[model samples]
Target: MNDFSPALYEVLYVSTLATDQPLSVVAEIAGRARIANAQLEITGLLIFDGQRFCQQLEGPKKQVLKLIERIRNDPRHTNVEVIHHGPLAGRRFQHFSLAFSTVEDEDALARMEQLDGSAALAAFENVCEELEL
Candidate 1:
């Protein structure tokens, strides 16, 4: 048998919610993502704060890009802006196929959505620590 591991890639993005009914819609999206992400060997976190979505996806390069393309084309999400995307040495969320979180208020959402690049990533990491996931 051959032992090989695919190159790992990660993507961080923020988007606006287009649907009026967020709770149910977000729930349905997360539920479907959990199964699909697992099959694709992806692991990450999804954060929603009423009007915005901040998500991080990590996996093999091709699969991660394809998943981001799908998210870009999804109607439920608008302004799908990728904050970061590139190689990762290891997984930040190895155990979760699609870990989910909700920002308690608009201030928290604004803080997360306002930045770009590594700062945005750091904000997400802070959330991960708070959630202890």
Candidate 2:
């Protein structure tokens, strides 16, 4: 019997910070998520460009879906838009449970916000390559 799974799942999304959300809340969320994601065997990167957030989560399909659902309901985030989601051949962020980055390229970030589907995913991939992580 084969025990290995064929692929891992990943979700890519962009969201806006809630009007009343404090900047300090990002650190708090990442702190808690690191612990929880590790337990769930999830790995991902979170990018914050001032007012917007772009995140890519990779793990078991079920767990990733559940986490996205929770994120959708979190009051600290609004306009949660899932740009891409599906099975991935491997983990893009295997080492970090929830690695974080803050981007300074407003123009690039703006382009990502306007894209959807594969284009959006491509933008995210470009951002990942540019990141030091």
Candidate 3:
């Protein structure tokens, strides 16, 4: 079987950074992503802690992949990890935003981090399976 589905769909993922970067820096990166998304017809959400950032990008597969590539190559982030990636049945966010939340705040970081790696990969696959994407 092919690794990617034949249907046209969106890609979603979360990226994390180290605990040393400032919120302003993260905001700037989010802003740039927003502009880029606008130009590319993509939409998503971005959350930032004082030190790290998490984002969910949804758009055409190729566009989302290009955006992910740019984000991964960006020098501003340290520990950029993909939390989830697959076809989103619908867009969760209308526009790209830089959301700010504290790492110590409740289960924000834990929740996002929980969706990383194999767990998240499985979750995305399940979503595709259930939704028939």
Candidate 4:
């Protein structure tokens, strides 16, 4: 019989536009992130509120942590913080390696704000629910 490894998930936080990154540049960043994540089999979603960035990554623990280390050293973003991390029964983001979305709806923004500070992971789930992606 063969054995398999369990999956782990992690959530990362970074200051939004804290580096004064323009939308075009952020798009570039997202593109790069998607590429790297795909190569490492990382799956997750990146959420933005024009104020900050919150991302959830799910995969094998070793790969997930390694990718996170690279993200911590990335100069394009600051205040890199890992807010939530642990083993997961399954990957929440199984469809995309790196999914990017923005909160443009006023009401959605309010709902997300309510999840921040003490509810970051939940906030990620909420954003996914709203986007259906």
Return the candidate ranking by TM-score, descending. Answer: 2, 1, 4, 3
TM-score of 2: 0.93
Q: Where does candidate 1 stray beyond 4 Å? A: 1-4, 20-22
Q: Mind giving the per-residue lDDT tens digits that candidate 1 earns over 42-100?
A: 99999888788889999999999999999999999988998878899898888889999
- Give the lowest summed-lDDT range of ten residues in model 2: 1-10
Please give each candidate's TM-score.
Answer: 0.90, 0.93, 0.66, 0.77
Per-residue alpha-carbon lDDT of candidate 2 for residues 21-128, written as tens digits (9 for 90 to 100): 899999998899999999888889999998889999998899999999999999999999998999988888888999999987866666787898889999998988
Scored by lDDT, the top model is 2
In order, what lDDT does every prediction score? 0.85, 0.88, 0.58, 0.69
Report how far off residue 120 is in candidate 3 (Å). 4.3
Instruction: List RMSD in Å for every model shown.
Output: 2.4, 2.6, 7.6, 3.7
Of 1 and 3, the candidate ahead on TM-score is: 1
Give candidate 3 misplaced runs (Cα > 4 Å).
1-12, 18-21, 95-107, 117-133
Each candidate: how many clashes? 0, 0, 0, 0
Residues 1-133, model 4: lDDT tens digits: 0125455656545444556667677788789988888877778888777666667787778988888888788776676777667777776667788888886653544454445444766765666677745
Which residue pairs come into collision in candidate 2?
none
lDDT-wise, the better of 1 and 2 is: 2
Q: Which candidate, 3 or 4, would have the higher lDDT against the true structure?
A: 4
Residue-wise C-alpha lDDT for candidate 3, range 78-101, written one tens digit per residue: 666777677666665543432233
The candidate with the higher lDDT, 2 or 4, is 2
Candidate with top TM-score is 2
